[model samples]
Target chain A: MTTDVLIIGSGGAGLSAALSAKEQGADVIVACKSLPNNAQTCMAQGGINASFDINEIDTHISDTLRSSHGLGSEQMTRTMCENSAIAIEWLASIGVPFSLDEKDNLAKRFMGGASQKRTYYAQDYTGLKILHTLYDNCLKNGVIFKNERLLLNLIVQDKTVQGATFLDITTGEIEAIYAKSVVIATGGYSTVYHGFTTNGIGSTGDGIASIIRAGGVASDLEFVQFHPTALKKSSILVSEAARGEGGYLVNSEGERFVNELAPRDEVARAITREINNGKGVFLDLRHLRREKLTELLPQEMKLCRLHEGIDMATELIPIKPAAHYTMGGIEVNDSLETRDIKGCFAVGECSNAHVHGANRLGGNSLLEIIALGRMAGINASKFEPKTTAKNQEQLLKDKHFISGVYNFTNQINFYEKREFLGKILYHNAGVIRNEIGLKGVLAAVRQMQKEFTFMGISDKSKDNNTNLVEFIEFGNTLEVVEMLLVGALHRTESRGAHYREDFNSENETFRSHSMFWKEDGVLCASFEEAK
Target chain B: MIKIKRFDRKKEPNSVTMEYPITEGLNLLALFYKLKSTLDPSLSFTGVCRSGVCGSCSVMVNGKPTLACSYTPKSGDLIEPLDYHPVKRDLIVDKTKALHTLNQAQTWIHKTNNIPRDTQNLHRIERQSNCILCSSCFASCPVMAVNSDFLGPFALTRALRYTTDSLELQPLDTLTAIQQNGVWDCTLCGECTAVCPQGIDPKMDIMNMRSKSVQNGFDDPTLANMSFGFDFTQGF
Candidate 1:
């Protein structure tokens, strides 16, 4: 397939980009690995942040920077905050039903890391509303959607990106697509934690993996944000809006341990520490009236009742921290274009423009995806088409190489290795990290990589083989996990989500972003001073 | 043991019930995951989020369309793909036709480029806009069983949303768009309202839209004579 722009992953970012590109008269084709609305953006429960009052833009920037802990780019934060009001307006124009107050104003609420009540919501399903609106707008604007197509490799040669190769999951066909520009909005790698995540099943950092396979560089791979309150044992999110709306967090003794409205990093760490101390954390909303709970946080109540069999209006909800967001991904400039690869741009959670710094705020992610996604789309639409013929040969060769390796017979249990890796990642690279634990994880991952080489698929049939797709995703997870550990190991100092036990305090000397790249198939990392 | 109705395309090309050991607290999606991972690697189903938000994992469990992510498996539960759409694989139905109805109904708020002035009265429409397009409502709608072209629940609920939106530029256009296989075709059976995971009452919204259409002097001829019959009885 050929088009003016090929957007991978049809979440909020990809769909927004597709809408922008199509509105700009570009033939946009969105290729998704799963259903269109299945991205993590749809799972966002809290409202999106925007300084609608205009005078609060500086406060928004300061809050974001304070939450990021000095790693977020001021330019990008300002851009995001400045564009937020317009982004909300654009969303409303496209039919996103943002909640309105009793006075008929855009309903705003308090969220962690915000100094003002500027988060606009449509009840509790803000992300779902925004995603559906964008998807509907994309459909109406004639943006072509090719679902069930997994991006396997990015065709890049001589520092230029052409298009990509995708595995059509339905027919199991390896098809190469050519495009003038490609946007990778495949979301983050929070699902690398697997059973302990709030992300969708497809959040395996596939875009970052494909970019790395194309010899691209990614930064800030070490910082992974763990949300404070995922439902115990299931990792389904109980939105921050619960706390933002006057819900409290209590220990097993029913004492409020931490300020519920504190920054996510602080609150998540508190929850982790409480769990570590053997005192279970619980989200208490039993004080709220039934009518208020239903009117305000209906989805949270429904989820709790349906999944955990607990009514929020009457019972205390068991909760814990879980891997929620990836603060690092494919490095991009202000234009949202990859630093190394021309014609390839990354946005949303998949691309680290350093807006979140080390830790992400509750409501800022939706803002970042829409604002940066729109910028990337507008810029990509105007870019001149480049020669993609040379890159096609290399991508095809890489495709065959992956198929040949996976098509082999072996005794290595891929599922066992994946489970082991997830445990290592959650335990060592999880909420708190230390030198010894990080090193241990790195060694374990290196051993698993050797076993993974002999991994084979049982179902070799070329028709909707989910096993093969999962196996491929496991490989990507391994790549991402290795980078995460390496980046965490090299950082050596605590900042934002990268908490180190030995270096428990943030050091000015380590106030720099960690950059990771591959050299001779071995992961290497370095630091660039904060800009 | 849990029994699953699986579509085996290779051998019989028909659905066959198979048995597997059940784990405690496993939703239907997780059961399918376990079955595909251990017993039959070919067992196909669509899931994403594994939460009820995305609506990609809707399936008929014990003859009722609901989200497999939220519906816990019971003993001998008969799992099947949602009705009113062609089954693509085991428990996976083609959602394209259902999704297309959304576009055909022009279910987006007509762009007014004007900021909403007063949104206090928008609570009803806002509640209707919560439709996740899950199609569980559509899958259970009796109106769709007989008339596939009926705009169904989500779409009409969507139309009701925009028609009630004071910010919408063309509210009348939205009401007119749903007049055909739209509100008039619905029997108001409330199946859609019952199956909605988001708690949107499409039946009530459709009735409200019907009243709005009548107020706009666009009543359906079939129902117009019924009102006349009541007027004739009052005269007697």
Candidate 2:
């Protein structure tokens, strides 16, 4: 079906962007690879902050800048900080009943970066509330939601986006959707790592891979944010609020090792260091306020206390660092429009809007998403329709490019590649990286990329074939992995989340974004000083 | 008392062990299911919807009352039947007494005619209706755990669905019956609401029932005293 705009990914970002586009009188269609709430955004347990009085903008902005370590864009950072309050206000306007303090004011508490109480939450499942609210409103406003449609390719012609081709996962039918504008909010590639705070589901980097193949440059691809604490065996995240509420990180010997309260990167790094040093760490939540724990963290606390047998009122919870956020993605400008592609916008975690810079502040990811999601949507609607005829030939050329992906005999399984890629990334370019490891990963990924080209596909005909889909996704993941390794290899210093164990010191040379593009199947990298 | 032995499943010399206080990740429901599936097929416990929504799995996992389905069984948990429920066998507890009390109290509104639902706002109450008949709220309530005859939070919350409806023909009659042993019994400590995994605000429903009771002049002396923060440090 034809539409004015088609938004890929039904997370908070995509739905919010669709709503914004609809608000501007654009007939928008939100398509998802899964159901609306299936995205990782709904799995988010902690809370999101907007710089209200409870969470002061100055402290929030300062914490964000501190995490970015002078690598974040001043403009994007400023815009995000300024717009956060409005984002929270908008969430409330749409009927997300945020939890309140005793005085009936918005509840706020310290988490991760910020020194002030700024996080607005609805119990522990803040994302679920926000996502359900946005989705319900979208339903009320008559925005069409197409579920289980995996975005396969973006149809681009003449340096502009035409539309996207998606495979209906349930029926296995491939449908080509034509739109004047397309917004990609397909989240990050964190699942590339074996161990992560993200769910086992949501690892398809469809938007990033499609955009990259369509010739969009991916910037800051190497910096991945690892959360300091998650449950021991399960990937379920133990919110940073655990520490913010006076929980302590204790070693195997039950001693507080690092500065109990420091930056997330520092704390996470310290935890990693402790683990590496044979001192397994645990979060001691035994002495925290019981009433507050029971009230605000009912679900998570119940899960921990009932299953773990260790009462948070008096026991140390086992913990470890797990991959959390990616500070790198499709490079977008202030308006969230890709630098080279018109009628194409990126928002949320998928776009490297440079708000978080090198490392993202804890609560800032959610805030930046809504703020920039709205911007991309509003800016996309303002675009005048192209006064050109429907280029059927160009459309056929785009179709051939997508068909080539389906037909390509590159029979690489993304799960296996994902496993291999994750090991390579974690082993080499993890919290601590060195020259030798970087070069090794670069050599390894390039070899995979090479072998990936000759991989044969038996089923070229695209019905709802997941095998073909997996094959294409592997190629895309490999393509992005090449950029990630290249970005990691090119940077000669430590900054924010990208710490080099060999370099060991934060270098002045690596103070901006590393942009990568593929030319003739060979990945090339360039740097742009932070604007 | 039940003799429950849990295994670590990790390859170690002492893998099999006894647990207390519901060791981490061992809800009675999951533990019982796991035991029955891989350990012994004949071992049975009652449960449905394994999500905390279904209250059927309300058992004491290591002494503290909680829903077994959602409760992860931890090591060293002293799993048992709820303090006040009839222990059937193993982890199963009979919920007939508690549920029967709710029914006899006429916990639901006696509808003379079906109120026409607003088709436009259909499923507005859908989220609230997502409650699985799990009595976790009943188990968590101190009053019900002590005085089983009290028209517990779960039943009262269900009653509010009918009594508070704008379309109900006899809201007062429904409200009066529920207020007798129902709304006033709640301590407002928010234990039931807090234990609810579905995010159903049972406390608010009980409070609404109290307000409706007060409006109809059928409010209990204890409720009026508690509302005004009276000296209730001594038992009524």
| Residue lDDT tens for model 2, B125-157 | 334444544666777788866666787776777
lDDT of 1 by residue, A156-192 (tens): 7777788889888877778878889999999999988
RMSD of 1: 3.2
Minimum summed lDDT over a 10-residue window in model 2 chain A is located at A458-467
In candidate 2 the C-alpha lDDT for residue A272 amounts to 81
Interface CA RMSD of each prediction in angstroms? 1.9, 13.2
Question: Which tens-of-lDDT digit does each residue in A250-356 have in candidate 2?
Answer: 99998898876787778888988888788879988766667877875666586565545567766777777767788899889888888677889998888898888
Q: At residue A266, what lDDT does model 1 achieve?
A: 82
> For this target, which candidate reaches the highest TM-score against the unseen true structure?
1
Local distance difference test, each candidate:
0.83, 0.69
What's the DockQ of model 1?
A: 0.52
